[model samples]
Target: MTSIDPQAKFRTGAVDMTHGGGGRAMAVLIEDLFHRHLKNTILDQGHDAAVLEMPPGRLVMSTDAHVISPLFFPGGDIGSLSVHGTLNDLAMAGARPVSLTASFILEEGFPLADLERIVISMARAAREAGVPVVSGDTKVVEKGKGDGVFITTTGVGVLPEGVSISPAAAKPGQAVLLSGTIGDHGVAILSKRENLTFETEIQSDSAALHGLVGSMVDAVPGISVLRDPTRGGLATALNEIAHASKVGVMLDEGEIPVRPDVEGVCELLGLDPLYVANEGKLICICEASDADRLLEIMKAHPLGQNAAKIGEIVEDTDCMVVMKTGFGGSRVVDWLSGEQLPRIC
Candidate 1:
């Protein structure tokens, strides 16, 4: 028998089918490995699932999976990505994320050391977001039957009374606000994967933005909608909101913030920065008067330091997102038929 170090073999023990079977191996792994990293009262209940107590408010829920290739990237890794993705989903719904459930699929022949690093990163992310992984499950597949590891996370939050937000609520004349710079996450991944050199280093904007979301909501109670521009980036997010609310958008090309390095990368690769992925950015649509307050609150936070009002909603017969170029021309921004950057989130 291979000696089990017994100290939560996060860095050594390879997961086997026995870890998934409801036997001593499962219990031991859960106790010494999973619970060891994700510590919380509800998790201590020791049941198959976590029983949570909800606050006095409406419930908001969301789920997401993390499968970013290379696992580790410039500023973050897959583990933290899992937590951030689900939390962002709940946050965009104007909810206070209370807890999360994690499910892991591990592949045979993968080193346990990498697993621990990922789990630790996730724990750190959840802690920073002030949420917990209250319950979770793990499974192992035969070699080549799975990627090294894939994590699916579900988050539940509570929305305060009178806090109604949705894409359908967006109105013409409402203002559009962006949380921060764009395309950092996509450029960071591409640089690492392709070994491209850049004058200034690019880092992934992978982070949990629930705190920023809370502040924005508090600043403006009547904020119409909030959407994080991720996989399809700002263009797709805005187009969706336009279609949802039956409004047209005229974006100020000069107003949108794009890092110079990201711009250079796009110029070199013929990619549009507006369509790149972002992990820590959000797009807020709100009444005209509330735009300044919302932007003020977003700018006050570290995650939204570069916040700006990029455009405004307009009344039009056709729901379209048209951008006013810097040089004086208009172009329609449409949804991407297929992903421009695959496996990004």
Candidate 2:
């Protein structure tokens, strides 16, 4: 093996076997690429794992693997999605995320330019969320054996005192609140698919929801449940809560927010927006009495400007989720039968 220039532009090169061989090439890649973008004191220590000084409160952790196709999408990419997904998981637990660890699996021959772009995006997202990527690892696989790149992120957070939020906490007489519109993220990814094009461009609502969650928790500490409707969309997310709490969810189709363009795209594709994925949105279940106050608090936040009270919990032996149609009809909103859109975060 030959020595490589540490100052060389990695963005112009392609990831090769040497980059993942745990030698000088790998060190140069880590220092010049990952370190340069995701620089932080903890990460600068250059250890296999970060030793974080625990903050005052209960600690919570969450991990997510992101392999969203079309690495680059309208509002975000795999890198940002990885950060948001993991952080949101912590936020749903009513914890404030503090640090993150991102691991990247790169395919040989993958363009370094794209990898650099993703890293930069991850850096920005983490910075904006006040969460730093304090540690990470990178590996390379044979070209044909891997996607361009797959990123997994782990997040750690501290839960506030007296705050206990859980899916099983949902109960009858609780109002269901959604942070914002649904299906934007799914629609955005679908529009970018190889042969699919839509009349209007839809941007993925991929964003970090910790701030929004913090605001809601601060206002209403007793909020029963907080969950991000990610992979299986709002329908699947609520269904999970219903089964966990042993309650039924009744939603008003008209009250649920869905962007016009997203609804149109769903109609064209023979899909239900309710079953599509969402990156930034969350489902909040709180006492029906707190519904109005919580809705006001959520709407004041930028992320929840379109927040609405979509439904409520009911006592049901079967723990089913039913939605009242706009035409005054009721229907069952069951678990997602099959994969609606695969590889979507």
Candidate 3:
């Protein structure tokens, strides 16, 4: 057994092959960095696999791999983003997240300072979400073969009885609600990547939605669908739900919210805000009769204060997503053909 010095600080030096060789260096790295910040009862067990006591309900599991560029962005970094992304996935299923497991792929010669920063951020995000990372693995790749670091997080949650939501559950006459303004996350990343500046700095809307989701489910258990518009943005998310439910989506372009600065950046770059990414937003689908009540509940939460009714589900065998323009014309909101704003999550 390799003895680790708990008092060791990685203020300098870079990660090397020895850190991932399963030796004393690896032990010191895990103890002084990862475990130091992310310590919890479950993780402290030091078992290869965590033994969990699951609550009574259906188990919900989601895995997300984050490879965002410019690891650090205006509002969040890879660490926080990884935690938020996976938790939001569980939240979209109307589940209460219980635990998370993180796996890291580090490149040789990566700075220990940056790694420590990311670990601290991840720990803070997990603590704020009331979720613990119970187990994880780490590996190092050749310097040229890997990016600085890639984080893959797997989240496990519990779905309460009598609450079910899915993309396929959307039906005709369902109201489509948006949690907040779109395009913030993508635009923020683009600005940072391209070295562009605007009148006001656009910050990524990265956040965990489980709290808002819990309240919404408690208020309206009949919600048909809940999805976060991430990489492909609102257009792709709605199209996906439309195809899954075999329904058509009719959206009022004017009803959707977009920040003025975000719109300006997209326009300058010849990109459409509708297809830009968002991290802290969600699309909620429910019966038209329950729309008002659900919207009220959403508006009451901090994460959903900007919620709005942007569209509705209609009967259509073709399963298309169409938007009514402000000019009184309608157009098909097609799936994003190729990657727009790559490495945006």
> Which lDDT tens digits does candidate 2 get at residues 1-345?
346654455647899988899998898889889999999999999999898897899999999989999899999999899999999999999999999999999999998888999999999999999899999999999989999999999999999998999999999989999989999999899889845676767899999999999988998999999999998999999999999999999999999999998999899989899999999999999999999998998899999999999999999989999999989999999999977899999
Query: What's the TM-score of every candidate structure?
Result: 0.96, 0.97, 0.97
Candidate 3 residue 26 C-alpha distance from true site, Å:
0.6
- The TM-score between candidate 3 and the true structure equals 0.97
Candidate 3 lDDT over 1-345, as tens digits, reads 545333444676788988899998897888778888999999999998999899999999999999999999999999999999999999999999999999999999998888999999999999999999999999999899889999999999999999989999999998999999999999999999999987788999999999999998998988999999998999999999999999999999999999999999999999999899999999999989888988898898998988999999999999999999999999999999988989896
Q: In order, what is each prediction's RMSD in angstroms?
A: 1.5, 1.4, 1.5
Candidate 1 lDDT over residue span 278-343, tens digit each: 999999999889888888888889999999999999997699999999889989998877868878
Score each candidate by Cα lDDT: 0.88, 0.93, 0.94
Highest-scoring model, lDDT = 3
Sort by lDDT, top down from the best: 3, 2, 1
TM-score of 2: 0.97
**Which residues of candidate 2, in runs, are more than 4 Å off?**
1-8
- Clashing residue pairs, candidate 3? none
- As for lDDT, the candidate ahead, 2 or 3, is 3
